[model samples]
Target chain A: MTRYFEDLEPGDVFETSGYTVKKNEIIEFAEQFDPQPFHVDEAAAEDSIFGGLIASGIHTMALASKLTVEETFDMIANLGGRGMDDLQFHQPVRPGDTLHVELEVLETTPSERHSERGYVTYEQRVLDDSDAVVLSLRMETIVRRRPEGQTE
Target chain B: MTRYFEDLEPGDVFETSGYTVKKNEIIEFAEQFDPQPFHVDEAAAEDSIFGGLIASGIHTMALASKLTVEETFDMIANLGGRGMDDLQFHQPVRPGDTLHVELEVLETTPSERHSERGYVTYEQRVLDDSDAVVLSLRMETIVRRRPEGQTE
Candidate 1:
């Protein structure tokens, strides 16, 4: 069931299962990587603009990446990511929120430098239980092409 | 000396202290948020395209965010992030590599909706110990405007 670059087409869509955001996990991750007041300290967060503890945007992105990898990348010949564009944090992710990802293929291009691999451009929208897009981004990834003699 | 919106000018620059990438930490972060074969399983990684286990791009980004917060955001009247653009992972981050961030203000715009805050656009470059750019992105954040009667 390994999907190569040739198998993905523009408009192909996939959805990932949910992961519930936990307050302790958020604080732990923020303490290690972000540590913004609103992300790590409940008391400081209460006085901040967010008015409560919230997951760091980087934490949300990581969550989205995890869910996407579990649902899709693990099933494909994904080499790695190249870059991302236009990442938007539409809504604050709270401790109790359950998040999932919906992704759609936007384009595929054969690599000029590598004949064995190609590139896939996809848009991922991370949504909460309420179906609101909490975060979104367009990612470009390297994917292996089907082998010369391999038939699907 | 809390720097407000009015205090940040285009071209202002800051540099953060370095953090060395640890193998165990990279594996731990990947296990939680990425879990790609090349990111989590060492044997699998050696056979993969990257040739070895490497830090996840998201992990690099999170590191950059932490460094920025420690170096600049903690000293500012910062509100929160709005969005990011053109995030490029220029190089793989390997264990034992030290990383730091250099950021420069790109622009500032008054928020049309919130008189109390303004927007600051900044570009951050995460560089390895060799000074090679490992990751880069532009971020937009909300910063409190200098309050009335406050002179500094």
Candidate 2:
């Protein structure tokens, strides 16, 4: 877990393990947080434009977040995010869809005011089993920088 | 849940009940999804720039999303979110903070490609107990249109 701002390159790629969407979890999440017909009611969803039950976009993002930390970001000197730009839902996440995440580092900037931290920008994508990018997000995460005179 | 595109006005405001953040929940969410030292380890957090345990930004958004549904969106003809823009984390959401959500309808437009549905744009904000905005989000949601000739 020694990853600091100095440890990451601009072109680095971080990947998360595959996670399958389950019907019950979708329903549960939708029931508690969304409750849209397209998300909560299977029969009604079949009649909607979506054609069937689909996971809420927030749920999809949450799942992607969970997977990213589990597989890739666990070792970094990670700080919380500052903001997100240009987040899009490219497609519906359906039941049984196995989703995987990829985050490409776009830039790393050392903080001028905060000596202990910096920001890392990433373009993150969530793809279904068919390799379709269902979600695309761009965000900057604050991370601790390498200590003074410490390369290792 | 009788809301339709035709019934919404641009200045409409939707508000949700307040929710208090718990230390264990913050730790649990971070343990599973964010896992940053500042978010998981209380001692480390006390030493970190945040100066105390704070919820993950994603966790904050999830809570806001949940409250939005429970208080307002549940009764609306919400289809699902299309995307989000200009999502910002303005301040740290710490344990014991009470959060409340408000969404203002920015605009509503009929879909050019679809006859039965339309998009509703909203500016969403999550305010802490002290009335500071901790999160700001902008997104579009698809909603069903009322019948061509029938109001009910």
Candidate 3:
């Protein structure tokens, strides 16, 4: 597991690898939450505006969260986030599309309380096999600081 | 069913008064998508970072979508939109927090290709019983033109 906020620098990067975007997962999630034609059944997708199965934007967003959890080794006690900006589905992420993601720290600040923690913001992006950008988001998270006696 | 885009004017207000937020719904939705301690089980919530079961941010976003749809009455074929800018949880939306919403038109413009249609952007807010602003979002939707082929 990576160290906490006190250890994160503005330029630090964390990569999450080996996650696959499965079609069934996309369909199921979309059916429940999104329910848009292009995101549910394949036949319905064929007739929809997208003309093929496209992952629901919300589903993609959730998967990014899952990726963050795995890469962060479940270290942070997530206090939610400030939501997202510039979220774009540049290209369709279909089933079998292996996902690779990197989160780079953009900024950090000490929290109001000196309770061994600080806040860090990251610019996260997910890419597919062809190096196409599938998703991009900005997330702010609170992380524990190194113990008072710990070394750098 | 309420009116469509062309029918909505600058000062118009629409509300979805029928839906009430239930605890079980929040728990179920959170368990599947969010799956955080504060959002899933009540007992787990006691030990959670959040004091009690809270709705997932994504689910809150979806509820906003449902209210918007109820207002639009399927008149517009929604193109995707720019993602949210600021999303705050405010007071955690517990079950039984009846979700009532209201929206105001912020701007409107014509679509170049579809002379019979145009796009409208609105500032939507979701409030709880105490009328606290629990959630707020901006939506830009394409709306069909009135029979007179209005120009704006």
lDDT of 3 by residue, A1-152 (tens): 44767677888887886578888988887665566566777997787545778886667766766676555535554555555554555666677888777788899888887576677888888888777778776766666677678676
Better of 1 and 3 by lDDT: 1
What DockQ score does model 3 reach against the true complex? 0.36
Q: Pick the candidate with the highest lDDT.
A: 1
Stretches off by above 4 angstroms in model 3 are A22-24, A41-44, A92-96, A113-117, A147-152, B1-12, B18-32, B40-44, B70-73, B111-119, B141-152
What tens-digit string does per-residue lDDT give for candidate 3 at B11-31? 666666635778888977765
- Interface RMSD of every candidate? 0.8, 1.5, 3.0
Model 2 residue A117 lDDT score = 92
Pitting candidate 1 against candidate 3, the one with the higher DockQ is 1
Query: Considering only chain A, what is the TM-score of each predicted structure?
Result: 0.98, 0.96, 0.86
The stretch of ten residues in a row with the least summed lDDT in candidate 2 chain B is B29-38
TM-score of model 3 vs. true structure? 0.77
All candidates in order of TM-score, best leading: 1, 2, 3
Q: For candidate 2, lDDT tens digit of each residue in A25-46?
A: 9998778667777888999999
DockQ of 1: 0.89
The candidate that achieves the highest DockQ relative to the unseen native structure: 1
Model 3 residue A10 CA deviation in Å:
1.5
Lowest summed lDDT across 10 adjacent residues in model 1 chain A is found at A29-38
